[model samples]
Target: MENNQPIISVDHVSMRFNLSKEKHESLKEYFLALAKGRLQFDEFYALRDVSLKVMPGDFYGLIGLNGSGKSTLLKVISGVYKPSSGTCRVGGTIAPLIELGAGFDMDLTARENIYLNGTVLGFTPKYIDSKFEEIVEFSELRDFLDVPLKNYSSGMVARIAFAIATITKPDILIADEILSVGDFLFQQKCEARMQRLMSGGTTVLLVSHSIEQIERMCNKVAWIEKGRVKMDGPAAEVCAAYKQTTK
Candidate 1:
């Protein structure tokens, strides 16, 4: 499928952030300074001329050290952020588990949030309704369905998030270390679900610190370094090269 049309085309994309040079203690102070022209910003490029192609059914892995802009690139591909330059074109439906509680209402009950989050992930109300019981069963939150999300543990939130995101077979699944918060058993469940997704021809864009997982799951790997793609190639080749950096 490498020779086929790309499922995801990221062409020379760049994401820029303007860092406020001055820190204000409160929103009032920040807004006051902004209105008076007393604030300054420094330009930062989270992604600089980064380009890559993810073909249909490709299980792509992104690896990097902390603060290397891996998440930013995911956000760009997820359409949470518009690139400052260039473009990212994604084909088909996307289920993004990039940020837990992203589309969730903390004050809402887990039962309510399932419909809420599912809609945000692009599921139609009727579709979500049909899959409601299945999602709840997978999440193992049938008992906690009425609990407010804010009161749930991180692991609990992760369970619901993963279950909802994977409720339907999305064309692409974007995950960012969400499994790391889950217990070992739950992580295994998430991995199993991902494996099923792969079997169904779903393209997956995953960011994880676990090189072994990447090596096991990804046919292709992209090593991001300081907002740029340092290496992009076969999983074995790029993982071996990336491993040398840790040594």
Candidate 2:
């Protein structure tokens, strides 16, 4: 990162969900139980008192075991979930590749969905028209443009999603397991694109399981264990420590 000012800041952030203990047969039954004061619940905290900061132009990686709240934390950053307590703040626009096929319409053709998903991501129709070919070129799915997205493989879907998300180079790019869906060669392509963005002063926050990838790409890292930050530092130090514990 080039600047001392944090482009993204998380302060004592905590996300909590109240899961109902009782399962009702129907909507009426659920309402009846609620009316009778018979409802019970348990609190599940996906993130607790977690704090971190990302500087401008940073390639920050988040590493953790599955179900360790890595995705949840990304959701919080993406504004998909509001924290039960604390705050998450970002200084600039965010392009989030937080889920596979998130902004796509499965029944629609890949061509139709480019316009659909593109508008949803805040691009104007004229703007999309101008950049449509570039998006297709990067995805390398020109032949499949007329095909329904439902027929596409996961890796194929990933290609389109990533190409669209990275088209304009927003102030911050947030990714969650995006590289894992693609084949090795495709993964390298994505990394190269990210490096290009980073060199142009874009900030990146990524969540990935590949330790080697994290070590190679990220200058900074945070190790989350059981919904809390277990360690945060330079990638080499954090990844090495995390590897030892897992071993």
Candidate 2 lDDT, 1-247, residue by residue in tens: 4487899999999999887777787999899999999887788888999999999988999999998899999889888899999999989889999889988999999999999988888988898898999999999999999999999999999999999899987999999989999998999999999999999989999999999999999999999998999999999999999999999
Candidate 2, superposed: residue stretches over 4 Å from native: 23-26
Model 1, residue 155: what's the lDDT? 92
* Candidate 1 lDDT by residue in tens digits, 85-200: 99999988899999787899999999899999988887899999999999989888888889999999999999999999998999999999998899999999899999999999
User: Considering summed lDDT, which 10 consecutive residues are worst modelled in model 2?
Assistant: 16-25
Question: Which residues of candidate 1, in runs, are more than 4 Å off?
Answer: 1-3, 23-40
TM-score of each: 0.92, 0.96
Clash pairs detected, candidate 1: none
* Clashes by residue pair, model 2: none
How far residue 142's Cα lies from its native spot in candidate 2, in Å, is 0.8
Q: Note the Cα lDDT for every prediction shown.
A: 0.93, 0.93
Q: How close is each model in CA RMSD to the real structure?
A: 2.4, 1.7
lDDT measured at residue 210 in model 2 versus the true structure, 0 to 100: 91
